[model samples]
Target: MKTDVEELTPTRVKLTVEVPFDELKPNLDKAYKEISQQVRIKGFRPGKVPAPLIDKYVGRGAVLQEAVNDALPELYGRAVEETEIFVLGQPDVEVTELDDGNQFAFTAEVDIRPKFEVPDYDGLEVVVDDAEVTDEQVDETIGNLRERFASLTTAERPVEDGDFATIDLVARIGGEEIEDASTSGYSYEVGSKSAIEGLDDALVGLSAGEEKTFTGTLVGGERAGEEAEITVTVQSVKVKNLPELDDEFAQLASEFDTIDELRDDVRARLGRQVKLQQLSEARDKALEALLEKIDIPLPDKVVEEEISRRNQQLEQQLQMAGMSKEDYLKDEEKSEEEFDKDVADAARLAVKGGFVLDQLAVQEELGVENEELSEYVVTQAMQMGVQPQQLAEYLTQNNQLPAIVSEVLRSKALNLVVEHVTVKDESGNEIDVDAVQRELNGETGETVAADDTDAADEAGVDEADTAEVDTAEAAEAAEPAEAAADAPAATAETAADEAPAAEPKNEGAKDA
Candidate 1:
């Protein structure tokens, strides 16, 4: 058996394989045995029928065809391993020559990782904002805490900002009542600016038992973007009574006994969050700098699929949120053209980043150990709101473990890049990314070693939000893996970040 690779493009190849008759003998035998069990001969037992007898009953062509189909995947995998070509999508397998007991020749054309030189990853400088927690932010945090403990008291005055109103609403579009546009006894905060457009403006100055009719356009439901006359009746108005920010309030709100102590704790928490933001900034900026330093030619087919997958996922989210695409576009303040461009750019960058890191992982000979995979599973399970066992079972059941392992490898590759790059804050002070990560992980407090500064804990960097729905298909989740023909693309974001790990399910490897 032999295989030769023909380069069709920078990102695709054709494998011409020649297998002599002896190489296919095992597959032929297996096919004969399978067909033997399915057919019943007058005197022959189900599993005891001979190969020649079975072939005489079932045409030799039929057995050969089944054998070829069963062997294509294994043959293609062998070709990939022999050439060390990173295949993207499934191959287009064609049996060019098939003569039983003589020769079997086939061709598989597949998308592959384009070969490119990696730019120097060392000394790449990335600048991040200073990790400064502001007094105003702390005050806001405390105010939010106070709001949680606040009590509501009936107010006998006109509805005002900062007051809560229990109201009933009915919406009619062009005089016909709209379904899903009516709710009773809904509690709303006047200044919260939630629920409907122009709701707060209409509610203000309307006293208890008073009714107001306003013209507005419904943003959701069958009447989305349709002009509607809404009538809102305020059944009762109540004002929030916040507890005083004294020592008593501190004890009630938190474990701290003193107001000053609670404030200090909040400030400390803010400081930690600030550190996390610094880490995220460094990561994004570093990746951007790395991308700018080199040019990567991404495959059009892969990029197009990525864009399509993202659009589909976005549509799903919009449906779940009861929003139309037009409404979403308006809310995001983007035109259709602009949104398309952004998706394209993001998709390209994503693929480029993955390709670069995969190359690094290979060059560095980085391998994902059981320890690393276990740690990642535990961390990812926590983020996905599932037990580690449950998440593992889902991945294993769906054949997604390959994707998860690839994600981990890519993350370590990125971390390796970070180790070589120079990172600093806006003030020109060198930023210790790993140290900041350690603080978040509660690994150390007093001092961090040099290695710790480089091996930034990959967990706790919340740059991307991932929702790991235990769905069977990844096409329904987020972006599918790169032109992953037989395996998933390396999608590790290093921080074991919330990534779309459920890769798309496709087994065929064919060409365009």
Candidate 2:
């Protein structure tokens, strides 16, 4: 057997392989055995029929076809290995030559990873906002906490701002009632400014049983931008009764005994959350900047495949939402051509980013640790309101765990770059690494070491126990003779932190 390789592009290769008659004989014999088992001769037992007898009955062409089918994958794999091509997708195999006692020749075209020089990432300067937790922010956080525990009470007066109202609404175009423009006993909040322009104003000053008519344009829906006469009849009004911000209220609302303690805790939590958001944004900016400096040509086939997958997923999502493709496109304000153009750009970005991150991971020798992956999976499961084992089963059933691991590793590589980079503020001042990390992790402006004993204790897990389950599984699968071989590694925790481990089922729900 022999193989020749030709470079078609930076990320594509064409391989021509030739298998001599000696190499083809084994496949021919195996093919004959397989076919002999499927056919029944008058006096011959199943699979006991001779090759020549089966060939005489089934035709020589059928035998050759079966042999070729069985041999293609093995031959292609050998050719790929011999040529040292890191194929990305399934190859397009074309048999070029096949003759009796001669040579079996074929060509395979495939996409491969493009080799390129990585830019210097260490000490790369990036800008991030200074972590600043203000009194106003703390106050807002407290107000939100209070709102969460607020009680709704019926009111006997006209609807006002911040008050909830039950109303009957009817929309008409040129005084003709629209078929889908009426709702009874719809509960709306005055000043929410969500339903339509002038809706809140119309609800205000209207008591129960009072009716008012107004005109507004449908901001969305089939008749978007069309003016419609709307009649609103107020059925009831209600107001939220907020608890007092006192020690007694704190006792009822949380485990804290006093309002001061609750307020302090809320402030700390809010500060940490804000810091985490800033860190995430900063990391994104830094990554985007670094990618801009790098040159990576994505394989066309990879981009096309990704685009097809994304489009399919989008179609599935639309169908599940009881929406047609046309309706979805209309809602996005895009034509088919426009949507395709956007999808192409997105696919290119995805492929390029993946390639660049993978290269970086290789260069940095960064990997996902066992404990980190386990912790990640466990954390994700908890967030999804499922047990860790359940989440694992779900991921396995969906065959998404590997993809998740890949994503995790990519993020870890990015974090490695970020760790060495110099982050500055708008004023050109070097940002404090501890302060930035606190903001990024939403750690209440507190800088804690990754191996913080107190945090581990709080989480009910010691450092050793945190090893990722996937890594452990891999190690157990390794044989003693092959134990010396490098074991499979789990995905990085930082990557898991950046993206939700599992895709969210509902946009409104917290990610797992």
Model 2 weakest lDDT span, ten residues long: 481-490
Model 1, backbone clash pairs (residues 3+ apart or across chains), number: 12
Backbone clashes in model 2: 12
Q: Write one digit per residue (lDDT tens) for candidate 2, span 154-242.
A: 78898889887879999999878875767898778688776768898898899999999999987656787799999999988878777
Residue 455's lDDT within candidate 1 is 28
* Model 2: lDDT of residue 354: 68
Best by lDDT: 1
- Misplaced by over 4 Å in model 1 are 173-175, 443-512
Compute the lDDT for candidate 1. 0.73
For every model shown, the clashing-pair count is 12, 12
> In terms of TM-score, how similar is model 1 to the real structure?
0.85
RMSD of 1: 9.4
